[model samples]
Target: MMAAQVPGFYMKNESRRVKIPFIDSNSLVIIPVSVNGSEPINFLFDTGVKSNIFFSKTIADELGMQYTRKLNLVGADGQTVLSASVSPNNHFDLGEIEGIYQAALVLDEDFLELEKVIGIPIYGVVGHEFFKSNPVKIDYDNAEVTIYRSSALKWKPFGFRSMPMELIGNKPYVNTTIRQIEGPEIPAKLLIDTGANHGLLLNRETTDEIVLPPLTLETDLGRSLGGDLFGLVGRVRRVEMQGLKFRGVITSYPDQTEFSDVIIETGRQGSIGAELLNRIKIIFDYPRERVLLKKGAKFSEQFDYDMSGLMIRVLSAENKRFYVSQVRENSPASLQGVQLYDEIVAINKVPAYFWELADITNLFRSEEGRVITLEILRGTGTEEEAPEKLRISFVLKKQL
Candidate 1:
């Protein structure tokens, strides 16, 4: 059952839990949230951010939020500059808990690029401060998230592996060991980030465990709040955690030259995100300095990647639309005439508007030799000129 909307405050009923189902998009936890009683929209449950961040100023305007001040923030180590406005106050609901955040920051960027990469609508991101006074439990297998009051909760692990975490400026860090095939395990520190959807990102600046496997693919990993975090994707022979071992784990390494050092200075070797975490059910107990993990159904599942060499994002101005923002060179998409800025108006003869970005993206990840039919609209439609619409078909091929 969806969480029932409640008013005011209620005393803690430790036994009572509000369960909110979540979508695992690119290892990022996307949850439905209603801000200021508005219609439910997708929000990234992120612990990496310092405060609650609304992706667009239009969101603040639509909510009738009054601005407190304006500030300039550097993101991704000066890769992209953010112009942000502070909202005086805001109320949002995550599961059954209602949170009131003060001085919420809304960015000028629409973050449609981010949605394109993740293939979902991410209206905003709620960070540490949003739940600083509360506790959250995340069950990856069941896709349920529970939020509890900090004072009314008592946590006891039942057969779950518990790891002691160190909180530095609101982020959790833990130590783990990673190894290449037949190599000795190398100890490394990783930040537990629920916001990231990718499995493992080893900072070449910090650790030397990021060795590209025999087979690797050059792809645009994902965009950061600062800018593009591009890198190569491959697999490591094994990764050891607490007393468990994950073999042949897919890993990614961001080109230090293209990324910023802000992540490295987090004082960890690298970061662990949803992809790996999804293998286990996790509880992020911030107030208690502990993270509980239990193996989940996905623990043994192999990690598959986007077979089509295309990066798509959405446009929400008039209606929701998906477009090809980037295409890999010499890949199946580029070989089949897919181009930058090509509007994906339809798929399999169905109107593109009929499908969500997630659906369109999933089609791109089909097994090799799978054929996909897409309707493409090229050029802009004008009063005298109409955009060229072309029907294109391509077979999905694994690049790696």
Candidate 2:
């Protein structure tokens, strides 16, 4: 109701509003896409979203879109939370329809490094507003969406496709049946985050339970929005979804963007990432409180990095100093008493700023007790003086 009062954006401004069967808050679907030639992989429909966004690197490279400039982003309270990788504006053609669009590359140790993205998977994000101009449905039953192109027709969920799902606690769980990707027999029950980039995410428990497949290929830095860190990069034989499956190389990590600690204890199942959601035509029946899961026609596995939160930026400036940038609320860094804007100069007598991603990872690689110290720069003017160097110890136990 409140959203209706304000002027809409792009498609919303000229949207055809028609209420279709909607799930809780996901009454509408938004899918902002860049038509890349005639590839079936171009158009996308997405629901769960706070905003519409896209990283400029892969999409720009694919279509030769010029991305210029850099932008900084602040949290809701206006603190510089992170920096954005910017590119020259570009235009998007959605099927026969076309529209000009702008994009921001998320650069922080968490989102990705523009030039170093792995596999160059998903191009950008589409919000529910994208559907405002067109009424679309995800039929979990048929694993496809029936589109109405015209809002004049009463919108209805056409295909109803529901994959067999298990719930962990209060979250939906999906079974992972990939070979050699063995973890505990207790399958993972994920939240079915339609908003997540990677179609699936492995929890620490699953990560610990499964023996890591040997690295067929290793990237210098495993990526995430969390900044360039070490992750085992390679492929797995196959991961299945309700008997439907695809074979592809996948990157495995120990962190989840949201619900980092959400666990599937006794009776809980694993989670579902966008990788699975985007593949099928499905509806999140929030109104009826069900996710009408379905399969998509275009089911080819494209290379995509399962990451979040940081941008990997190479320092070209000499005498460059790295600040804390910003810390995640109650994160390990914050819990250790690290402050924002503090300069991390070195670690336990080891220089940190110029160190490669591998260096930091090496220090934390030990499967036993590991502790490192930091020499930080804090304050300005009178605060310009260095704070007493503090040493913090952290355990690198198998992340569960």
Candidate 3:
């Protein structure tokens, strides 16, 4: 994407810095944005995407937005392509900052189904456009984003480590090293993706050194623009970024069969997502092509994966209702008789309404062999008969 063609935002007034509070949902940042002066709607703050995109066309239709053209959006897997309409000259109000005559892509259908995945209403994604004209600081500890004017900002290194960044296709990329269990450190060029939720993603086909671990688990990685992405989950010995070293990092390797047709950039290994990024404070200086990082509250925390082997989805965020969307075969949840579509009514004797989605996920990824009780509502909701209510307990164990 060309710099001139990229959509950009401008500061509304003489403010040198603008602070925007965000909601951190499962390692993803959700911010409130108003379109064409409409009420604030939740939008994902992503660095991996080139242009702003609306997951559904409903919002655009409601705002009486007109389509200037149609675009074909390809998924990361490279096979799934969806058509989207481009609404040009739209006004975007991000509190203190505003974008006039901005372009946004609106999908005909909500292909990602992000609400069910993230347990919130995610109408769209705001990407490169937000960072093009300013330096953005992401404070994971405080759940806030601060945008600073390039001219008014002062450089204060302090304890922060500065590393060079490559701005390619309107996205940020950084260089890092990965060490396998029995091999030399492999240098990798990874995209700094704030949109992805996983810790580390490595494309095995990128190089001979980037191979899968001995033990791996076949799992549903996440949803893409196309559909659900299936992949293998494993662990690498360590990942080194500059002088910072992270040991036993949880890694993801997407199935090659699905990515066979995908075209990756030269020397681009994979991406580093929010899972690892949440452990540090980051300042993205796009103008200078450098990123400053400092250790955060979770810097020393060990990396972990979901030990319960159950993928839970939010049925209703307001009602605090959740259900098992997928259960891994031969896993703890399956072994304990946790069936698919089983509504989670309570956990550890507490009502589901009392627990947040993040709280439940944190418990699932807690210590191994940790036993937890679940109050499940089973059976179809049809009028044939009342749903069966049962109690099941399961021990969470590491799969990969």
Candidate 4:
């Protein structure tokens, strides 16, 4: 059930637990969030979140919030969303916790929902932005999460470090660092985005906010996780998690702004994206209010990438349905004229069947420069005089 909206303070009920959904972190209870100088307000514990977001506009207009100008948002999907600023005070009377917080006003928005009732019109989404350095622990069985300040334990299996990020209207925002493909690093306090598929998404207009070096790479457009935003793709100079930094050659993009549900206006300027993937073992701790990225066992061959511009899916001939989705651009599949929506009828003279997408791509990405034959049922020809089981041979390429 969704969390029931509670206005006044209530003692923690030992008998029942509430469930709420958050990105970076998935689901947790709605415990009271106490500010330095205000009443203890309710907050949903979310691990899916990479930062914090408090909608100042909703608070001011609906809840009578005080002060500020336009706000900006840095989202994890690698987009910069700017907004008019506002004071976080009117959003909630967090008493003593009212510090100089950056925020944006918001209307009804969503990130993810693991709730059905016990609903809440979120004033803000709080996440890892609260703590950066170490890993925070969440005891869902016990209904609590712990963050260690100063002294940290040494027994961590994955030494992942997460950085605190700020969000506006639910998306993360930050200054930015867009590294040129060659030479020097362009300083950008970009977003810590997980909601994006590729690494870095940059725009000359927004990325130029921070002084950067000359860019040498060509970029293009990319799709957002929610398909809500189009982002510029290019490489980042460096992506840092806590003090552990990874540098050099990465891909990013440019142009077009992003509008996300999870990335709210809470003062941050940029969102973090794919630059942090596979490179580190991610302990995306939402309950701990931090995203811990650990250096995990790296396979030397794992990073060896070759694209065969074919997004393929496995299907059961009998079921007449697909079970895979692997699309690579500029690949043999593209050269051989394999359309995206093609229905596969056979594989190597046999009626092919697959249970998962992984199974298809495993066969597709494999055998580079090797000839593979496929049989397809391309739509219809009259009634159903046996849908043609095509046999076409093609070679796979290493570039996409």
Predicted structure with the largest lDDT when compared to the true one: 3
TM-score per candidate, in order? 0.86, 0.39, 0.94, 0.49
Ranking by TM-score: 3, 1, 4, 2
Query: What C-alpha lDDT do the candidate models reach, one value each?
Result: 0.73, 0.43, 0.86, 0.41
In candidate 1, how many Å is residue 31 off? Answer: 3.3
Global Cα lDDT for candidate 1: 0.73
Error of 2 at 195 (Å): 6.4
> Per-residue CA lDDT of candidate 1, range 93-128, in tens?
654556554457888876435666676667888777
Which lDDT tens digits does candidate 2 get at residues 147-211? 44343334334555445443333233455565544433334444554544444445444345555
Worst 10 residues of 4 by lDDT: 1-10
lDDT of 3 by residue, 285-356 (tens): 998888889999998999988999899888998788999998999999899899999999999999999988
After superposition of all CA atoms, the RMSD between model 3 and the true structure is 2.6
Q: Please tell me which model should have the higher TM-score, number 3 or number 4.
A: 3
Q: List the residue pairs that clash in candidate 3.
A: none
Give the distance in Å from residue 326's predicted Cα in candidate 2 to where it truly belongs. Answer: 26
Whose lDDT is higher: candidate 3's or candidate 4's?
3
For model 3, the stretches where C-alpha displacement exceeds 4 angstroms are: 1-7, 152-156, 257-263
Number of residue pairs clashing in candidate 2, backbone atoms closer than 3 angstroms, sequence gap of 3 or more or interchain: 65
After best superposition, candidate 4 residue 181: deviation in angstroms? 1.1
